[model samples]
Target: MSEKALVHIIEDDAFLSKALSRLLGAAGYRTLVYGTANDFLTQLATLESGCILLDMNLPGINGMELHAQLRMQANRMPLIYLTGEGSIALSVQAIKNGAEDFLTKPVQKDALLNAIAHAFDQFQIDDLQHHRQQELKRRLGSLTVREKEVFDLLILGLLNKQIAYQLGNAERTVKAHRHSVMEKMCANSLAELVLMATELGLLDKTS
Candidate 1:
């Protein structure tokens, strides 16, 4: 995980955009600037995990519309909206639609920096959780047919003997499978295995 998250500034006002970039740069953040939404979208696929500072009023494809497109595509980058002549209704709508923060022009330096810090923190947390889920899926995929069966029953609160009886296997064989399940899943105990199963959505299906 990178300590300095990128701050993408999408504003048509060159002066404000430049000032924001300098401010963030001085605050130990990496930044990319775009004069329009289209400019930002051009490199969307290659953009790393970060947050966006979007200007509400742009020449074309405004901030709100771009945000809708980003959400539709499942983009996870947190966005903060900046507007010169913002309305209460617009602010409410932006927040309701998942904007990190909405700020009127002439935003205080502290407020802007605080919002950026908060957004970066959230992005890091979300990125970590996404990676954890991916790793769990990978571990689950490594299980064998028998090991998977044992794992399912184990998380369902089945004992080794009961699992062996249900699967028509010897108790010793079931025990071996159980051990393999614990090893392959990297689970420390039965409780942790159950928690992993729940996170992977297996518990609901089995229950």
Candidate 2:
């Protein structure tokens, strides 16, 4: 979270772009301006990070068109759309097109900041979940075959003694395997272990 998240603005009007840059800058946000949707698209590959603030009406490619292209191409950044046409229909249409917020021209500083803060909160949430998923995969990788088998059974409400009987192993061996599973999965308790497995989509809900 540095000022590195460039809020790319796509507006043909140079004056509005300049005003928006100044406004966003005053609000402690890093800003960038694009004269057209094509310009933004061209620079997108060079941008490894940041969100987009798009103007609905543009010269070459429109904001809605750009939003559609980005969504189709699996662009991950949040998009906030701005427009002079403050019609309810257009606003609803913008939301349908995957715009995070629909704003009219002469943007209010508070409203703009609020929308951006919400978008960034979502961004942070997504970032955290992505990292957590990666960590889950890493932890799952750390589990041994035996431990994974024991984990599968343990989540099914099977106790150590039952698991031992099913696996044709000694009770102590089953306990050791279960303990190792818990440790490798970073689970503090059996219930927590089950929940972890459920979150990882390991649980068959139909069953």
Candidate 3:
């Protein structure tokens, strides 16, 4: 099976666009070309996973402007610039503005493939970290107001009797709620649960 990745080429030159598209397609990469910045933006909302190959110079809304637009929209898609010779300043600017890398035209097949691979590797790492943050938030949200209180106390090394006294609840009531808290948190051990609570800044105190 061909493990091809989708690549979006934002180039206006018909000859270069067709040639580049053919080169990438031959290398087992699914390719799409947009002739203008506006065209790319129109379809940006519908895109899921694809790295952008942008041209530095364009007729309306040039490459740098497009780069800023993507940032303003809070879209973190990987960008690789395709610029002409003597455009080092523009290439530097692209890197500062969050481009993964830029390729000078006429682009080399090996360099282009390597840049695409590197961009996707970074994209995967970013996706993983983003999901991990979401999961931590979900787990923390599982705690009830009262459960949070008991959890904080438990982390402080408070016995059930002390926790009951502190919260003005019976020792048996504290025990029941503690069990419920552990189950909701999916913590296998008291120490492990305490560590999770501490990492989340939910532990009121530690012994």
Candidate 4:
């Protein structure tokens, strides 16, 4: 788990929010408490990476509505729903909508901690993937226009001679461009280059 990972607690009940914060704090987890969905949205742009503990019933925008808004904005924060009135239908809907967990209030200590741990684990996985994607994008941006063209054709199973014929270049020039693509992409093999192309969604674009 990341040391800087925070848990955002958005609950209308001040007493419950404080109690939950204390519990999480005692367990060595950092928490930020918000009294309403609007309060949370105010800091949405600047919020740190972590999970959310959202109350089902809020003063203004309810939890489900807030969740929908986050989804629309493409926010991928892990969220756990806390409801005083447990409804199976609501729980099912939350899970289907990508909530990490749904728990009834006065949530069990073990259950809450476990859910938070799992959420943090998920956050780490997502954070790692996001970093890898950015790095791959950076590498791809380093390629010249001609090298990029060669990379695309090479991943599509084109031989050097075929790529040269398509681009009206000498076979040796195409081979040079292919070598540069392989080196710039830091791919050890043709299979690795294809995998990188897949990660960059180049295969989808070509298909």
Q: What digit string (tens of lDDT, one per residue) describes model 3 on residues 1-207?
A: 126878899999989999989988987889889999999999988975688999988879998899999999978778998888537787777789999997898778889889988998898888777776566668768888888789878878889999999999999999998998888878888998877766666655444
Off by over 4 Å in 2: 3-5, 59-61, 72-74, 86-98, 165-170, 204-206
Best by lDDT: 4
Could you tell me which residue pairs clash in candidate 3? none
TM-score of 3: 0.73
Assess candidate 4 and give its lDDT.
0.93
Better-scoring candidate (TM-score), 2 or 4: 4
lDDT by residue for model 4 (78-111), tens: 9999999879999999999999999999899999
CA lDDT, every prediction? 0.92, 0.84, 0.84, 0.93
The stretch of ten residues in a row with the least summed lDDT in candidate 3 is: 198-207
lDDT for each residue of candidate 1 in 1-207, tens digit (9 for 90 to 100): 376778899999999999999999999899999999999998999987688999999988999999999999989899999999899999999999989899999999999999988987877788788889999999999999989999999999999999999999999999999999999899999999999999889999998
Clashing pairs in 4: none
Question: Candidate 4: deviation at residue 73, Å?
Answer: 3.5
Candidate ordering by lDDT (highest first)? 4, 1, 3, 2
Which order, best to worst by TM-score?
A: 4, 1, 2, 3
Residue 54 lDDT in candidate 2: 85
For model 2, what is the C-alpha lDDT against the true structure? 0.84
